[model samples]
Target: MGLFALLNRLFHHGPAWLTFLVMGLAAAGLALCSFNLLFLFQANYHLLFTYGAMAAFDGGLLQFIELTAWGYLAIACYVVAEGCLEGLLTRIRRAQL
Candidate 1:
């Protein structure tokens, strides 16, 4: 029936509240990607122009003090970058709705 078709299209493709859920999952996936890359570049890898990662749990927070300021800074920067990307995706879903 036309009525069922209309409802189906609205829920499936047109603006609807459920779109927010899909957007959130997408944001999480993106953030995870960012976290992995950050972990790789700022901490994990050691190849030309790269420094090696420190054992985060070795001595706990106290050991953080031994890191160069840039190393410490990268940790904070990565968190913010990932959070912002998630927020952006959330807003995008709301906008579409």
Candidate 2:
């Protein structure tokens, strides 16, 4: 897809660690929002990041951290696969020349 290509180009030159950092931040932000909404129905309230971090750290809030890890692993695998495929295609084209 065009969007995929665009994103790949944008990130291709950066350190992979940056991508993971951004992903974690994004997940934390979403968790914070989710926690705030979920807390509305309960009598208890906690600090925003505290509740959000619980989603990633605590065993009771939710397993969002595990889910995020899985998602990141999947994306890493895809990038490796794509890179291998591109390399193969380049080799094949060179052979045909």
Candidate 3:
């Protein structure tokens, strides 16, 4: 029963392949950029490494806090827009009926 319930829950969440695909593409792009910065652009490697280390050690929390605020704002805006669209569609359907 638990297994069936879990499967049912998963099935209801919609497909995940597209999300995974996009995430994979983004990871690949980031890897490529890092590879290029570290290898292809050898002249700037030391500067990049220093900055990266600084961000990794010193600015980690600061970066997360700053980026998280922007992320939250973007998500909130998306949710509001989605709700508005859904409400508008619902009203249109009711009017048609």
Candidate 4:
């Protein structure tokens, strides 16, 4: 009985820890992406202010597109993190049953 209880606790906590780790990583990724996106926009805006609109637009267009892709990637990471939590919750609920 003691051994089974110990094993059960280990198994239960292991997945919880794993879920937290994954969520933390995903949050970090999202923060990095958001910071980069803001930095890029600030730099582009500076360029536009220093240079003319036409010159800035010529170079900044590519940056805008790249940021859009990164934004999507950040969203994907968020979704994955949410899904992981949801899956973990479902498992816990089924175990309780």
- Choose 3 or 4, whichever is better by TM-score: 4
Provide C-alpha RMSD values for all models, in order. Answer: 13.0, 12.4, 14.0, 9.6
lDDT of 2 at 57: 52
Local accuracy by lDDT, each model: 0.47, 0.49, 0.47, 0.71
User: Top model by TM-score, which number?
Assistant: 4
- Over the stretch 1-97, how does candidate 4's per-residue lDDT look in tens digits? 9965654443345567776677678878888777768777778667767777685568766766787788898897787567657757767898899
Clashes of each: 0, 0, 0, 0
- Per-prediction TM-score: 0.31, 0.40, 0.41, 0.60
Preferred candidate (TM-score higher): 2 or 4: 4
When sorted by TM-score, best at the front, the candidate numbers are 4, 3, 2, 1
Q: lDDT at 25 for candidate 3?
A: 53
lDDT of 1 by residue, 1-97 (tens): 9965653443345443554444455455545444445444544333322422334444423333433444555554454445445555656787899
- Runs in model 4 deviating more than 4 A are 1-16, 36-53, 56-58
Q: For model 3, which pairs clash?
A: none
Better of 1 and 3 by TM-score: 3
**TM-score (C-alpha) between model 1 and the true structure:** 0.31
Q: Per-residue error at 32 for model 3, in Å?
A: 26
Off by over 4 Å in 3: 1-60
